[model samples]
Target: MLQSIRSASQHWLGKIVLSVIFTFLIAGVAIFGVEEFFRGGSSSTVVTVGKTPISAEEVRTAYQNQLQRYQAQMKRTLTPDQARAMGLERQVLAQLVTEAALDQKTTDLGLAVSDAAVLRAIQDEPSFKNANGTFDRTLFYQTLQRAGLNEPMFVREQRSVIARLQLADSIVSELPVPQAVREAVHRYSTERRAAAVLSLAPSAAGEIPAPTDEELTAYYDNNKASYRAPEYRSLNLLVLEPEALAKPEEVTEEDARTAYQANQSRFGKPERRTIQQISFPDEAAAKEARARIESGEEPFEAVAAARGLDPKQLDLGTLAKSELFDPAVGNAAFALEQGKVSEPVKGRFGTVLLRVTAIEPGSIKPFEEVKDEVRKEVALRRVRESGFDKAQDAIEDARAAAKPLAEIAKERGLTLATIPAVDAQGNDPSGQSVTGIPDKETTLPAAFRADVGNDTEALRTKSGGAIWYDVVKIDPSREKTLAEVRDAVVQGWTKAETDRRLVAKSKELTERLEKGEAIETLAQETGLPLKEVTEIGRSQSKDDLSPEIVERIFTTPVGKAASAPSGDGRAVFRVTAATMPAFVPGTTTDGQLVNSLRTALADDVLGEFISEVQKSAGVKVNQTAFRRALGGEY
Candidate 1:
């Protein structure tokens, strides 16, 4: 279903329908930072496309939205200057102008979108879906309200977008690509290639000696960004996991004996037998075979062989009485005498003959023998049952009394531990983790968000215990001193030196190859094994060689050596062979190539249509609004 939907979006008809629906549904949610910038009203217009007006408020909101989206995608915050450098503001402006132009064209053409179409599109939106997957009116209103648009205003915007999409789709739908063009695309995407790789890893240089103080300092200075510290918070943890709550000494002799008696079947094994049999198709056939065996006319093996059963099939092997889950099979096997063939008996799968070769009798250990194990299990169960209730009660009481975690722990027998300071990555200033905390991923994020004295909700662990914590303090991020990260500095220095040596070694080998020396001879000289990989496509991933090396092999001239950094070292390569598959006619064609080609053409047409509209109805921009969005006064 998903594949069809995806393919439909790529296909011409599906594209038109999906585009209309998509544009109608998503109106203001794509607007970046309305809550951040739309704090007050403004009368100024930022852009005027033909007769349509886009207010300064809209531009600011859109620009901020664009900034935030970029920041999220890049996973880093950007300053106003950095955003401008990335052309974020320009991209947002282009989008707004294009949309406004389309809206103007829709108005000029007098395109009419039915109220029912708009309503249906809105109702079908997944964002408005409730837990039962039906549209919830309350969520619809709330979502629009959050984006700073009332229901009427948002619906009006959607109506315009829908009309524009209808006009655009009519112009761009059914764009076609030639069969030869599609074949070319398929050949390029599916073609495979092979390479022979000789990886020169840092290990080839052997063990690296320790760096001196000067070398370490230089390495640290060059790579301070790698050592930059993350924001850290100090926290007080309330450990409520089963491992923390369980007490071994709580169980007594009486408890152990009671537990043992209740679950005795789990402790001791039952008598077992190694049995064999020949299955027959019917009662008459099995009875006939039994009679013949009894009269010595037909051997049991001969009967089984006549039925086309192998020796392994005839041997059922040793199994405990309880191991046979079917009651009929177990009953029949147990009733048979040792070394004697029994009469055909009815079972679940078919009729069966039985012979018990050996019987291993069962035995049970005395209560005293497993008492300690039973006592531990009983103690763990008791603690698990009581721990959560005890912790929750104490936490509530502490909240009511306005008492600290340390005080409550003393009063309620809870273990209270404090982490002085740990980064978001869960490491302290010395780069050691704040250990002994259960559910670190859950607890640490919650701790960072919490302020001192703010109570946190209980996070249940996989085990039946709640991990509770409170933020005690926040330690602002700062650059680490040389002494704090000396070990890391030394390690970096050693790696740099090793990589340098390896690169020099690789350069020597490449130079030798250039002088007509074979790679096999070079491998022998360097005491490294030469490896070859055949028919490796560009998509084939290699653990020994980095992606750069694989790409280099394809691009490198067949005889000329190319080098790339490989795992702190370097790899030298020369392409021995290259083959590009011919575009074969009549390969599989399931509309995939046509879909991709149509999608590309349709996109270009839509883009050109929007641009033509923008050109025909020129956009007027307000410089004041642009500067204000870029941290300037209006």
Candidate 2:
């Protein structure tokens, strides 16, 4: 049976029959019962689920496609090591394993799609449709060719995909979500609270004494990692943008004039008219509509309204003659006086009558008036066309001769900038942002990964320019001595001590309030101002009270007190009121919450189903073959 299946797959009609039968027979004994059915046996298989063998080539192809997608997103090519570090191979393998499990289950259930259904799907694909919105055979074939697939392979794959989709839809489609669950989520999210909060400033810590030398030393020692400097690199950058290389003095009068003539349309505005139109099925209907408007039997807007057209549908906004879709309509529209309707005109689509509402006259600046601007424009264009290539060659030649970037810049008239010291985040040793780094996103990462005195590769800019960089010096990160950062350390210790004292003070105050003392009485006694916040939800955060305080407010019962860290000090808040609005079904917010919960539940159910299927079918991985497929050593 297996030999006959293979033989049948060689013919066009037989291939379709094979596909229809493929899912039913794929789990038969001929394939799964024999361990050596694969061409290269177990060595070529990365993973096997039930009767399905996921080959090394399949893994490699999937991995490469994923890598290409990542590269396209980052806008830069990534090395194999970088992809490996991202764990893309593991993600791809896991996804393939899940898909194989699904496929196995589908086959085990004898799921199959007919050839006519697959053909209908192909014809329905929008990518294979022509301008007339019908299937184009040539377009379908061309698209398949571009995707590196033929008719038979695509049909077979599509058949399998549809079958797997059927299995998944049966498991998860339109799963019911309970109303009680929706109400619970809505209540939790919409619950609001009111709290009376007393602010505690750092000074409330009562003038924290200065730390002694022993204390400061111990503090610095305990938090040495915070005082360590980041690794910094000194760099020289050569940027080749159009403006930097443009030399307006080099542009002659004749050249400027030629450029001005070539781009005259860009330097002037064209005539534009605001027009309205009403179309008819034939010229006679258009003529009748025009005569009615001309004879004052009805206004132009009334005529439009009679045809069930709104003002927006009738009015074509201001457009130039070239911008109009139909030349005949455009000509008639432009010829009409403002507020006057045109005669019946036959346009490309149909017959129409046009009304010109307003017109703006065109104007162009004289050559002499814009000569200086034209010269600069020409000079920039000239440099932009070939400046980067020339600069790159000069830099390469200078590097081969061991000349410094500054010297190369002076000789070749390129823009060279020197950054004395910069961290990986483009900050200096003092933590000040270092400005004027061209293409910093690309340059900084490359610079940090480079060795000192080595020429880094040229990076492309968004504006068709290029930047080359060289790491000049490296400043290794090291822990700072207490003396080197004594001021910063003293400040840190003071803040920490102040916060500790403030927390203690807040706790003491909170305990008093919890013990039946009125919050207002305590606030007045402590000489602190108390503010009442109302309608604060779980997600609310204010200037004085942070989200942490808001969370504590919601968690505390009414009339109960809790303490949370605020900005610089701590806040002691007493919950005054709590409210949970009644959940109204089918409200926008309720509907959104219901949809979100339903989606999450559906995903969980589908995931569990797939996992169970995988367990029942059994999954085995050849670690050596998997690693080899990912370009790793066995």
Candidate 3:
């Protein structure tokens, strides 16, 4: 059954529908980008799914939507060339063809959505709701208008969408996993294995002696391409940030006290109580219930149950002083100690009988404990609210005059620093980040755009400050001279030789184990970190033991030796025991496990089912029309 599902879903359409588009539609919101074509002239059909034509206009809209989505997600505008490079045009066209094919198949199967169902689907869309929580006709039309869609076009699209969903639901609902498959999955999930593992660390490689000059020279020559230095630029930076401008001395004790007093919610909260109560029709009945609890004739829960109120229905959980709806009941309840019953108190709802189950005492941070932090927060907020005026002023002056940023720094009382040769990623030759450069989020793109000899226009930063930079020098990337990276090259060569030796050592150890040498005895002889694991389920993961070793232990037969690769070298393990728990029928735990496995099996089957439908219906694409709509020849 699993193999059949796997075979069915191997098609491209199945992969796109099950793995890719489902996520794209849910989170990324795939839109129709190339909608402009639909408004003007009639174009050639780009694809045909059965008798339905997916016009060039629809394909164009999808491509445009995809382009805008990419730009928004990446936070960088794509040039026309970049957009073409992504192959989004083909991806979007194929998606539209899949939708058309599904719609065609659903229509042939008579799975049409009724008019009322379409109305419900549209109104249920939270986008069409107003503050009143009902569909607003004005908003409905205005939103579609903003989307470059008319009522007719949008309604048609929604109709197709709802019908396609109906088709998908039927496919998912029809597939079922066999009983044997379910049992097989249960045994796979619950089975455990035991093994003793001999860990081979880099130390096991045994202090590999220094390499010969000929070997070192050959290693460097063969790997020269990987030794090239990245392209780097020298930069002069001028920056202003809100936190940097906030002087600690400017903040006084009075300011911190005032901030702490005004923003009490941030520092501490009042005491909260968890309470339960039952409303009564009259004061007499409420008083009677409270009296019964006070006399121990009945507990609060007993009284609540007698009144047809469930414990959960009566529980209000924990709430702060101001959260209560009735001040009379709240004041009375807060005054009572835990396990004490409050007297009947008249509230907005009715006469209520209340009991406090628990209380969390309120407390405030001592002034001295928070003084320094409070003062700094107040001063920084004040500076940020002013929009970092000093930085803005200095940046405007530099941009208007096109003067070097370093000169502007002196005039504005700001610090200016030069970052020696650093790569486009802001890493210096040593591969550490270049210090004193502006934050990478704002600087990397701007630095790339700036002319080599000219200062950039002031770029806005998240701190509401501005930064200016100049590209002082550009060094094209190239292979570094051997003298420049001799240490790094030697380090790399040593590590590679060590790994090779480790593999050989691990193989030798495996051979000994296969020859009846106990793993624990071998560990003491070789000085490796030795350990044993028993009765651990296949799905269990361990931090100390590598998952690769656990997997290999389960796959190897009892008494057989196997080796699995680790970060340093390898784990040579011998399986001692294994077991598969028999699948018991009708138990709730077993049923739940079987159901979970069936859900996955159903999805695989459904994906295969959809692909078969698409193929049987037949899909064709018009190369010329598709190329024209996408604005390219593929």
TM-score of each: 0.49, 0.72, 0.62
Q: What overall lDDT, based on C-alpha atoms, would model 1 receive against the true structure?
A: 0.70
lDDT of 2: 0.78
Cα lDDT listed for each candidate: 0.70, 0.78, 0.73
Candidates 1 and 2, the one with greater lDDT: 2
**In candidate 3, which residue pairs clash?**
32-61, 33-61, 33-64, 33-65, 34-60, 34-61, 35-61
Q: If candidate 3 were superposed on the true structure by all CA atoms, what would the RMSD be?
A: 9.2
After TM-score superposition, what is the CA distance of residue 90 in candidate 1 from its true location, in Å?
Answer: 14
Pick by lDDT: 1 or 3, better one: 3
Better of 2 and 3 by lDDT: 2
lDDT of 1 by residue, 249-327 (tens): 7777787889998866567876789988787889899999989988999988898899888877887779877677446
Model 3: per-residue Cα lDDT over 1-634, one tens digit each: 1111122333333343455344333322122233322222224887777788888778778777777777677665555545556656656765675677778888898887788987887787666665334577777787777667787877777777667666666566534657787787777777788888888888888897787778878889989987998888888878877877777578888888898887665667688999888888898998888888888899889999999987678887788767775678779888989988778888755687888889999887777888887888898888877747855775776668877777878876888978878888878988898777766755875776666877456665654566778899888889987777788788889989988887788888889989998998888887898778788677467546677877877788899998888777788888888888677777897677666765576566655665566567766666667778777744
Best by TM-score: 2
For model 3 the TM-score comes to 0.62
| lDDT (tens digit, per residue) of candidate 2 on 611-633 | 57766887677777878887773
Quality of model 3 by C-alpha lDDT:
0.73
